[model samples]
Target chain A: MKIETKVEKFTEPLHLESGRILEEFELIYETYGELNEDKSNVIVICHALAGSHHVAGRYADEAKPGWWDKFIGDGKTIDTTKYFVICSNNLGSTFGSTNPLSIDPSTKKEYRLKFPVLAISDVVKAQMRLYDRLGIKNAFAVIGGSMGGMQTLCYAIEHPTFAKHYLAMATTAYTRPWAIAINKLAIESIRHDPIFKNGFYKKDDLEASGLPGLAIGRMAGLIAYLSPGLFNRKFGRDYASTDGLYELFGRFEVEKYLEYNAYSFPKIFDPLSYLYICKTMNIFDAGRNKDKLADSFDKVQGKLHLISFSDDMLFFPEEMEEIRDIMIELGKEKQVTYKMIDSKCGHDSFLVEVEKFKDYVSEILKD
Target chain B: MKIETKVEKFTEPLHLESGRILEEFELIYETYGELNEDKSNVIVICHALAGSHHVAGRYADEAKPGWWDKFIGDGKTIDTTKYFVICSNNLGSTFGSTNPLSIDPSTKKEYRLKFPVLAISDVVKAQMRLYDRLGIKNAFAVIGGSMGGMQTLCYAIEHPTFAKHYLAMATTAYTRPWAIAINKLAIESIRHDPIFKNGFYKKDDLEASGLPGLAIGRMAGLIAYLSPGLFNRKFGRDYASTDGLYELFGRFEVEKYLEYNAYSFPKIFDPLSYLYICKTMNIFDAGRNKDKLADSFDKVQGKLHLISFSDDMLFFPEEMEEIRDIMIELGKEKQVTYKMIDSKCGHDSFLVEVEKFKDYVSEILKD
Candidate 1:
């Protein structure tokens, strides 16, 4: 299947949860399948950090399918043939979205660090605006994992009737302290890059001198996303002779794997956008102003399907249990269901363990 | 009690496990209590990464006591009244020891990156040379935690009769892949600092510009050294409004704590030394060059006391179990004992939860 990205411009001034306003912004999105006459068959798919509008299918010039290609194609778990899937790039991401790389109309220059700080709710609001523009009054479901899951939860709470089903995978209603510490490390890594220059460096210079810091941040994040069991099983004491001398810098395969992924990340991702997104993630609290999590969930009328991986160290299963227990205590047990996927892939299980959840997802998406 | 550092110079070249050699080096150490006439009452205490010779007691001009002062004073756990204690700065650290910051006699300049890459065995060997200089043929016990524990294990395995008792705390006989990954991040953080300039920058410039990277590295390492329960209990989402406005960079108490420690680290630590030490840690495998761990322990003759924290994520109790199980399989279980310290302090429990283990230490050290 082939897909193309489309842009929707919201010219009206938009207010952000951070109390900052954007005069105008554009959302980049891709759609699959046909929308029903009532526009009620639309499923909004939110992307995680580093993900983009391309959730499934390949573009004409692209060699690879979308990030969620396995689960969203025809006859797949999401079954694009049965539902219209709309995946949009979140705000503060560099993937053709209104992010730090986007130009500021007033300054006629890239926003860079001047870009408004965003909350997960802001990203959800932008998607809701896109839905309104596309005549999607009610979505069949809102589904995502990690940062994407944050958006799904936000949509379910803020717009109770906007979706019939909400699926959150390998994520939490609020960022925990440990996760916040990891995010802080990543943000500091980018900020400490000498060429970052307080996020004011020229794009080329930033990419040049800032890539190492970005790579280091990604490496650190990757460690959190993986389980020790998986790493040991995959690369236990296996040495790679880097210089043919079998000496210092001769690395274990897992270390090489992390370094490779981290080094490659800067080629496609912007460090400033990464910092902003991580900051937004760090402040994610579903019940920020509410008295408790139960109160926050009171407005979420959509049936909730919470999925967590057993080996996920970043968003542990205990975190998912916290949300489930809160819902149970609020007498919302009938409206919520929790599932734990037993896998050694850790937090990345949401992306890699699709086969493990294909049947459960299909059952939940059924009419 | 007031204590001071004493240096021991080894003019003979030291050979490292990495096939590198140091022409000459010095060990900065501190001692408490008097050596017995037979030189059989010495207890060698190894310091962890970032730890120094000041294991106990305060210096005359200092406000704070040694890092492990609570556990190593006159009548503390490793009581100085009964056993003469010697704590030496490990190779590849910067605390007045021969390290990357030390001068090369031939070059008349700091060794910097020119310092030989070292292993735990190399550090143990250096300490053994110090013992030879002091005319101590055998030690009553070799005790340490974390990297210090690694040294204790090395001393036991490499010099079978050098110590009568070996206590390894919150550490492993081999560095796990996950640990290597974390260490890699720390090493890369230091190397990526542009001011590091491949470890050739002027000392002042390196300290000023490279401190952020060093701090970031420390922050990352600190995360592993703590448990989530401790963070939740200690700094649970309490926000600090910097600049009198809750905005971007407004931090949680935990973030501030990590940042403060990270920022303060460079004032006393060297990035090159950090990298070298982390590299050494990454290669710490007691079974290295041996077909199996049992083969490595074949020569070990000391009575073993293995201690692990229940909540230590870095060196999990499972890791300690692995070593204990290996000893059991080799019929050395009678010579070994294991203890789990139930604490929320994680890897730092060995240092902070001294009260929990004072009696245990005293019992084990008693003749």
Candidate 2:
């Protein structure tokens, strides 16, 4: 269960939907298992917001394994023993990816807000280039959840035959107004931080200076990720201090939990990147020019699998149902499979309900 | 209709559940209609968090009517022609109440963070005192919704015989963890605003300085106040400018709406008061010391009417169902009435759907 990140530099400029270009960029990725002689058993896994490319295994000096270690390991659902798995840090992300926090080649200074705005399609395009560099002509499957799910759909729509299977969990083809509203708050939280200095704050003091705004944004996001039922069962009106200390500020257990995670988020995350990434999510619309979503999926040749969580407030199960209905109307029912995971974990269910998807994943990967 | 705010000063010290005291505080209230002989037709209305004593009618030079003007005028739901109405701002609020922004007589300065933490019972106690000063020994009914609804329940429980009828809408007897989490974000947003200066911000610069945090907090609260369906129906993915003029921000119609309201909120609200009021809401528990919720209601000798919004994410309809079940178990079902308003407006349904409640209110008021 050891993992190491590898970086690849692409000299070609990335033309963004915003009409901006990144002259050159690097993509950091992690690979599990070895590519076969035919390189036919490759699976590309996408990460969500606040997630990195380290989908499985532990890096040296790390206390915890990768985010999806439970689901993607030697003998896990996406068994590494049988297939080559690749997960890369998305563009506009703060990991090892060439994001706003990365140094600008011309100025040797951080891009900060100067970085080009990204779209979900741009993220998929970068990953597609990474695969091409590695000589992966076609991936056996592209699997992801949440923002990752958005990427999976984008990959299928853009490349069509590049991936044999596309599995999207707890995501929508188009961003809903409810989600846009939430993302707006997160962006405003960071922008309102005086220390943000319009996203030009001192890089050395980034964590301390913009921590308040970034933390607030992260707290709101965490609440959206969790279900009220889960919150009630886990921390229902429970006081954090039995001695009546911190009563005015940190009284509830749920408040303390949100505070801790929020405050710690800026330690590793960049506020500018957070704003950029969330803005990308806010404008995500797969069928932007099409009259109907089914029209966009017409070009997709990959087998489509839509997984939705019943308790997810962000990408509600009904939104997933719409996608399923569209596919049926297009007479692509044979190529589509829709599964709803009854859960109380909300949008985070895709990350936490690994066991529930074991049989589904195994069956999908069998071919 | 015309309205005027009146302030009543009580020299007697108000003792709080937190063991703190507010010496010589003031209560701001507005009256609509006329109190009949014996004050038997008097109805005490409670305002929600961020609401003022201005519940009905218009003040001098005002362009807009009070928050509930539509429902409190002569021919409205809470008809002024039939019932004498009184609405007061809560103690820890900015609207002419003795809040954190109120002056400390001894120090001759704003109380700021030095203001004692308030409880829902404390808010109810202050209102009860206001009724005493008004010479209204007993109210015919106490009716309110949302945080105001919480106050209605508190009024009925703490002063069981003070009111003959109790109407609570879109609220719970206890604050849920989900609500606590949302309140925490709002509080954090204000506290993190650098201009807040730990609540010692300059009084003259209050609106301009603490606006960022307060606005962000309000934006979050507004999102919670609305349901996803309402947002979808009202705003959807419609952009503010079809010409793409405001792409970086202010893109979505919902985002623009949230931004406008969030920004304007600080014009009339104090950050400290917002924090205090939300905190008061977080600690609201009607059955604090009781073995069961039914035990808390045992002393009640009034007809109970509970109305919940079907689409309210904050106080779900199930929460109201819990109250109904408890009353039924206690064999008080005959005295208890529960109704759910099918709405897509979320927690704001109580405020927005007044026309729908006209018949229901008329029937309840007949007694």
Candidate 3:
């Protein structure tokens, strides 16, 4: 299916969890399938960091369908034909949304570091406003993984009756210390780059040289997103070429693979947006400011399905199990389901190993 | 046990595995305890990346002991009372050995990137030369962990009769793709820094500014050296400061910990040495010229003990098991012993959690 991105303008101030406000902003989103007359078949899809509103379907000019095209086509797992899927580009994301790269209405200049720090809850609130404007009173389901999963949980807790089913995949209820350290590495890597110019580099300059520091950050982040088993199976000890084995700058097949994927990232993605998103992820504590962690679960009225991958080191299966355990302790196990899928793809399994969880998703949608 | 570093000059040409030659070089080493008559009590210790000859005891100016002081002092696991310990800085390391920072005799300039890419075999050979000069023949044991472990394995294979026992811990026979990818991240992180100046930055400039890029690399490397379980237990979701929770650049307790450790690394470590060592590690294949991996182990004439950590993501327990399994397949099971120590510290377990394996070392030394 071919789809077009749509933008909606809102003048009302968006009060963020950080106590900052975004006075005027635009929500960029895409929809798949048609909205049913009753609008009960709506499914809101949240995107991870570096992800966009284009979750599935093809554009007129692109060859690749979407980041998650595999599970959302006509007869695919998500079955776009039955459900009207809505995915809005997250606030602070670089993908055609009013992010750090967007021109500030008051200053008439790019926000850059001037953009207020965002939280997962703030991003969810912005999306909720879009949902309100789209006339989506009560959606059939809400689905996401990673940072998106955090947004899904916020939706379930903060707005208890918005979505009937909430599917959070490969995520944690809060950003743990291990993951926080990883994010710090990425941010510092970008910050150390001279070309970054304190996040005020010209777009043309960034396009010319590309942020090597950002590339390094991306490379490190990519490794965390993948399992060592997957890497061992994919590249082993293979060389990039035969001649440079003994050279100081020799390339391994794995290094080449990472470089190819990482180096090209900075050319398209904005550095400030990347930095902000990392902060947003690091401070994601669902139970923050609550007397008890179970209090966060007590507010959830939706059927919360926490799906995790066995090999995901960044957000371990135990993290998702903690959410379920909290719900169980609160005698709300009937409202929460936790499933850990066997996968070697690690955290990226949610996007690439859809077959492992598709039947379960179909069953949930059936309910 | 107070110790001082000693340096010895060698005029003889050292042929490297890369077919390059070091015409003249200096080896820096340290010794502890007493060398018995006939030098039969000699125990050589190999240090890993960023490690030096200072394997035990304290210098006059320092308050802390050596990196492995816990297991190397008198009546300790290695038992200095019964053995004389020797540790030499590895060939491309920055710790007082002739590394990239060393002056090239021909040009009177620092070698920098001109330093020949070293293999683990080259490092072992250099240590062997130091052993010969010290009048130590067929020492009781050769021991090390991580890169040091790689050197121990090299000693077992290349100089089979050099030591009676070889103890290699938390290491691999070859640098697999997973580790190669990680090393690439570190090298690239330093390379991306503008101040790195392609490894030619002036010493004064480096001292003044410090390589932020190198710090980022170290931060990433440190995380890999430790397990997520350790980080969770140590830092959890604690904040660096309570006031900056919603700030974009607010630090987590984990971030502060990493920053404190990582930022100080570049001040002392050389970026070029870091890059060269990473390269050396990536291309370390024991069976490089051999027809089969088993052929490399076939030359082992001494008892080989392979130790691994349960939570080591860098070098998995399965990797050490592979070495033992290869020996068993060759009908040389009697020649090798494999032990996996349960620890949450990951690769650093061999260094910090020596108590867990000290008794085993005592038993092995008794033979």
Q: Among these predicted structures, which one has the highest lDDT?
A: 3
lDDT order of candidates, best first?
3, 2, 1
List RMSD in Å for every model shown.
1.9, 1.7, 1.3
Give the winner by TM-score.
3
Which residue runs of candidate 1 sit more than 4 Å off their true CA positions? A207-210, A242-246, B1-4, B106-108, B207-210, B242-246
Q: Which fraction of the native contacts appears in each prediction?
A: 0.70, 0.76, 0.86
Better of 1 and 3 by TM-score: 3
**Separate DockQ for every predicted complex:** 0.63, 0.67, 0.84
For candidate 3, the TM-score is 0.98
Model 3, B1-367: lDDT tens per residue? 5355799888788999889998878889998888888889988998988888888888779888899999998878888888888898887888788899898888898898899998898888887788888888778999999999999999999999988999999999999988888788888887777777888887887886478878888888899999999998998888889876888888888888898999999888989999999988888888889998899999999999988999997999998999999989988888888889998898999999998999888887688
lDDT of 1 by residue, B254-353 (tens): 8888988888888888888888888788888999888988898877898988999998989899998888888899999877889898888989999999
Q: Please give the TM-score of chain B in predicted model 3.
A: 0.98
Model 3 pairs in collision: none
Q: What is candidate 3's local distance difference test score?
A: 0.88
